[model samples]
Target: MMYRNPAILTRLALLVPLGLVTGAPAAAQEAVSVEIVPGAVSLAVGEEVTLTARVLDAEGNAVDAQVLFFPSFADGRSGSARQSIDVDRATGRIRAVKGGEFLISAIVATARNLRGEAMVSVAFPPVDRIDVTPLGGSTYVGVATRHRATLLDTAEDERDGEIRWSTSDGGVATVDRFGILTAHAPGSVVLRAEAEGISADVAYEIRENPAARLTDEILWRQKEQFSDGVGYSWIDSLKEMAEGEIGDGQLARAAARFPTNTPLTKEAYLYRSIFASHFPGEPAVRCAPEGPSIACSTPAAIAWDPAFAGMADPSGRAVQGVHAHSY
Candidate 1:
């Protein structure tokens, strides 16, 4: 039963067993009597509460009583599901059926002697929902494909970042303590995020990157830096091409700014395979002129079959280039 001070029941769960006699001492005994210390009551749907029972002789010494709780949901609510658990000798747990009133009860027996029953009402909480953000694209092979999600209250208000994210795809991806995802291999993964009892989920794919260190370095160096009186964005250092928006002269100077930055390389045929997997209507060319090997695609047109979409970067325009097809 629910109690005003819960610790008193917790202590009782542990101590109730101390008074029972087992094995050698009980062979010659008469029938033991059992009675539930806590009594019965009504509860709101989905409420959780605790129960405890005691077995004793007519003289009032605690005896060994085996407790067994039966399902007795309210008349029409019998269809609701309930689960009960024993935490210790004197205490057990019970959850009420959902969405309606519930009648909960418990029983115990000392040897073959049946004990009395007891219960109390608990109110079940409400249903809730959550929304998860996309953790798309491959982060070099063997890393988590993660999605960020925000929690929502029952009223649909966004709760602060008090979220717990998990996954069902242990073989494909693993989640870290801070909700960062790591791909375990080249395959699909499903991720889940939850708060309180509410939950939501999404799925994505991941693969290994043969050029992981190099890719990481490029992504890392792109962070803002002050090379001189002029501050540079890491993208300003890559190969540049003229877009409809930016002129070739400006693109050339931006490309010149970081002549020292290394070019991203194709490590394996697998790289081509992944790039080719882009969806239809993706941009095919970005860093260069509309060419054969663009990574992204423009929305209004579909160009080459192998080319998905053009990838745009801050780097200046030079000669047009293509990223190879995915393996």
Candidate 2:
């Protein structure tokens, strides 16, 4: 059965156990009223406070009695989701867990229990910083990734607080309340998380997904092959001219001339000589692609075929099995 007054139920719940343990009759321990010293207090999370309880007899004389502390949410509700406080039963010491108000009831450990209560207010500690994961990075358009934001106090201890997530450019990307980032288009944007007047940002770049445009029909329509599409004889003539114009001794000296990405083939040497005449610096060389590649594929794609690892030619026909005769 539910008691209208929770204090009455608390007393009833303790009577059976205390009576059985103390071997004291229900009428032996008598108390007219009880009072808690420093009846109200306010503190921050992780802070502690101690309370003292006193019992008085009908004659207004102080009585010696053991007191136990119990916490009930002052809002008249009890649930695990609500912020909680830890109270020591034997010693009226309380440790704040989160931001909330609580009512601490002190019961005299007796067959006839007399209760006293105090109010407690707890506030969250101030946030010193907000740390975000994957600080600044790149992702493909239409892809989604989860980001984390951690709030810390001045002591570098994690503090519990709500975080607000936002994107600098909504057109480029969007972030939800939980810090899940979704790329909408190809662009650069900044993601921000804020809490307790402290905020942090992460730069993100969203690029187009190349796999979506690799269809055979699109490839045939683009007509991207520079020399082969025009005439086969033209590329053969160019290769023969490069072989006669560049000697092996000049190819060996290619590295001394252009330290960055020295040409291995005579054709590559001829092209680098022409290009270097116009732009001759490390900055210009960085603008051009220079890596171990095959079949116009990236250096990472060399793992697909063992032969690709040894081939330096970037022609699409260099790949043995993948190239179709129709192309």
Candidate 3:
């Protein structure tokens, strides 16, 4: 004999002809229930989540049945009708199309109409791109500039997020975590900003200040003044050469005559005169040209002069009338 409740019979009568209710042994026909795995979920727009429904008999045993999944908004309207949720009926995959809360249901059609549901809350989309400002420019050493990083969403709207800033060469330039750049030396460095797996870079150059160059020139001039027998006139000439007052070739010839190993003194003018005669240029000082050896020196004479020559002069110009002085 089949024990039946009037309410269940009425439900079965209303559902049976639709092929939604299946007939089976009384034990197998007991009231059924559904349990949805992962009772709740959270996702972002354009993100997907998988849901599963398990049907159980009244005795708490698992059973197989054809299940269908659907979604509804908080207002009790169909989510699909509102175009906010997409469902794969065969696989029970739910994709969020917009930012909203939804109730997703897995239903097993039967005499008892067993069903289970999960609540899904979809958040706003994450940032897809990062934009950094002051892209390419130069800064003077020891100067600072403020930079900015803007985060943009898929729709090109500005969004808010944490950003990280860095520089490729810390010695040339440095950026703080908040994107403040400071130039430390003369060179180029790449600045970068990162947010939500997206990154942007800007190339920057740091240059020496004009005042810094002037200071370096002053220090070099001071060092030259301490040399023995190197008069203020010679130092002034070197300063003029550095300032482009003298031509490159002339300056090079003048530098060739300076004593290297020997202390600069009056006798140093002899080597200067010898170099001037062979190179056809006037020396810083005039020397008598007619003496033993014609008072003009050979390239080897300058190269072997223990007081003047520390290294050989590559130019092998030979001079005949040369004299060496001991003063």
Candidate 4:
């Protein structure tokens, strides 16, 4: 799109192909028009192109005038549009940073109204490889984990594309379109991610959950779970009693009392106070189990059950027969 404002500049600037410019006399220096040479061009990523601006008189004679060049997206988009191409105002040298089409404008600095524009199109290279992290690893049945895949060009430049995920043995483990893998049974399987005809694979082995196995080994007595190992109502009874034993004000000041891993519940406060009476040392307090956990499971095992991530209790009742796996 080009327009001339005769009201702003007496002379007109015409954008045209590169051509010989005849010398203009001092009087002819009042350009009738200005133009940018090479009206259009196309280049690949990392390529460079230079544009020339000429202020011409009525007889197509070159005139003297300071010209500046600016680059903008042809489609009028912003952000990455500015990142796609770079231009030197004084030299009109443009470098393609990414694939996109842009318009290069050459304006007469003195007149401000006389200007010319050129079109430039940049091409992007193809994806040459796919890289997946944890190329090979092991997980447990009933456990889930997320994997990531990145696309790269031959030059190792990162590229953007949609990835399709799949699993070789669905019975053992399954992968979703977003690369989340869920272990269904015990076995070995291959996880694959594909994009632009390029694919990457990750080998995995699903084993029986050791937490579930440990329960089977030590489940001789009734309810052999933490917090409820003695009886299902034991912890509940203690919680009910603590609600009366500890006042609201005391629980509010639990942080000042225990300092480390401050008790958040009446049941927790009751237990902490009792433990402090027996072993009243900062080191012993610090040794108390802390961090996120579920059903006596380790912090890492919490990943297996998303619901466990925010759990404060280490009781085994939520996951009745499960415990943290040593492996």
**Per model, how many backbone clashes are there?**
44, 0, 7, 3
Predicted candidate 4 versus true structure: per-residue lDDT over 1-327, tens digit per residue: 789678544432332222223354333357767688788999988889899999898789898889999888889876545577888989999998877689988999988888889999987778899999867788998998888999998656688899999999899999888889999999999999999999999999889998776655476544446656666577668767999999999999988987798887787788888999999989998887765566567778889866666665655656633544211
Residue-level lDDT tens digits of model 2 in 1-327: 854988976787888775654555555446888889889999887899999988888877788887888888888885642246888889898988876789889898883357999999987566789999978789988888899999987656687889999999999999999899999999999999999999999999999978667888776653424445665566567778989999999998988987888887887888888998999888999999877666556779988777777776645655566555222
List TM-scores for all candidates, in order.
0.27, 0.48, 0.32, 0.53
Alpha-carbon local distance difference test for all models: 0.49, 0.81, 0.67, 0.81
Displacement of the residue 130 alpha carbon in candidate 3, Å: 0.4
- Per-residue lDDT, model 4, residue 40, is 93
Please give, for residues 1-327, the per-residue lDDT of candidate 3 as tens digits: 989899988998999887777776344545378888888999887889899888788877878787888788856753252377788876789888766688888887653356888888878666878888877688899888899999987756577789998899999998888799999999999999998899999998788977676775576542311321354455445434444543444445544654332212223343444555776533433343422111134444554545435322211111212211111
Off by over 4 Å in 1: 1-127, 135-138, 144-147, 160-162, 210-327
Candidate 1 structure quality by residue, lDDT tens digits, 225-274: 12311433333332221133345454445434323321222221222224
Tell me how far the alpha carbon of residue 69 in candidate 3 is from the true structure, in angstroms, after superposition. 27
Ranking of models by TM-score: 4, 2, 3, 1
Minimal lDDT window, size 10, model 4: 11-20
Q: Give the Cα error of residue 280 in candidate 3, in Å.
A: 87
Error of 1 at 219 (Å): 14
- List candidate 3 stretches off by more than 4 Å: 1-122, 211-327
Candidate 3 clashes between residue pairs 3 or more apart in a chain or in different chains:
294-321, 294-322, 295-321, 295-322, 295-323, 296-321, 296-322
Stronger candidate by lDDT (1 vs 2): 2
